[model samples]
Target: MRADPTRASSADASETDPSGDDRAHDAAVPIARSLEAILMVADEPQSLVSLATAVGAPTAAVRQAIESLVADFDGADGGTRRGFELREVGGGWRFYVREEFDPVVRDFVLTQNPTKLSQAALETLAVIAYKQPITRSSIAQIRAVNVDSVVRTLLGRGLVTESSTDSETGAITYETTELLLTHLGINSLDELPLISPLLSDGRGGFDDVA
Candidate 1:
């Protein structure tokens, strides 16, 4: 027997794949599609490392997938440009509504949602009112609850507005809008009543509204 083919083939296969990483990568969902699914529901911009780990792909592959998504959303590959785009801001990727659609979206939200805010919304709003330029994460930490939907409700009602996303972290800060002042019939935030007296522990961290 001249050098058994079975042993030779086994040796070659072992040499080619010393680790099972390739199989795992191949088994994962397509990188681009998986990334899209995650970014769609992501509240904050996702960094390359985080996204790569999340999708079980190599960083190089994830970067390539991100580029492909950016082009696809921008219609650079001969398709209609989407109403939203994948943007890299604060050193991470996130989706943003096209600026031109703002007015239409705003009008629709205002008209469609007329019922008064639920108690949760009111509490969330109070936190933002006093902690101007606060991030959603901070709000949730303070209230000890998730406030994602409540923040969206405030944004839709035009009672809360966002500041520029943090340049390094991609964190979006929120503050009460003029509409909030109008709703309260207050000329300025300073005019709001002090809530320190109402605190059980008499904490000073709370401002005139929080």
Candidate 2:
């Protein structure tokens, strides 16, 4: 018996069509893994468009991935809810420690790791303590080097915090925390050494050093 030509043509079409098995397989691969990996190290929340561009996925696909992650973290898939959650904030997405676990995380961070600050961190902290509500650029100018990592370390240690952002320049201004005072055993910044006595220029303490 001869094979039917129409059936043979149908089989050929199925094999040749770009929308056949290959596309289905690609669709089955979840984009959540890509999104998760990017979110893990992101210091700030990323917008959907930004996330899509980073992962080289379509915006709709990224959105769907975010939804899937949210569901999984919420235990909607019959699994234990995660201690942390992906959250959308300020028009972007980031992971946050779930409110119920905040105390545990905070305590662990405070008690478990009491490592000493580096010399760079001490100098950055001193600058922030004296010149507070100062921009990172100004701090860098005073230090005559990049202070990014040291400033981040101070922030991580809870010794410095963002006081405010400049309205015109959009620069973040940092200030020392009460925790710094507690560590220094001082009541106020006035307890710090006088700048004039330390400077050869007598008018510019930090600038002279810089």
| Per-candidate local distance difference test | 0.85, 0.79
Per-candidate count of clashing residue pairs (backbone under 3 Å): 0, 0
Error of 2 at 5 (Å): 11
Specify the poorest-scoring 10-residue window by lDDT in model 1.
20-29
- TM-scores of the candidates are 0.78, 0.61
Clashes of 1: 0
Off by over 4 Å in 1: 1-29, 166-170, 204-210
| Tens digits of lDDT, candidate 2, 1-210 | 999999999999988876755664355256788889899987556888999999888888788789878888999958889999998865778888898985787567667658888898888887787778888888888888899888867776778876766665556689998888898899987788776667677654265422
Q: What TM-score, to 2 decimals, does candidate 1 have?
A: 0.78
Clashing pairs in 1: none
Candidate 1's residue-wise lDDT over 15-100, tens digit each? Answer: 98746766644544388899999999998779999999998888988987888788888999588899999998677899988889
Query: Could you tell me how far off, in angstroms, the CA of residue 203 lies in candidate 1 after the best superposition?
Result: 2.3
Q: Which prediction has the highest lDDT against the true structure? A: 1
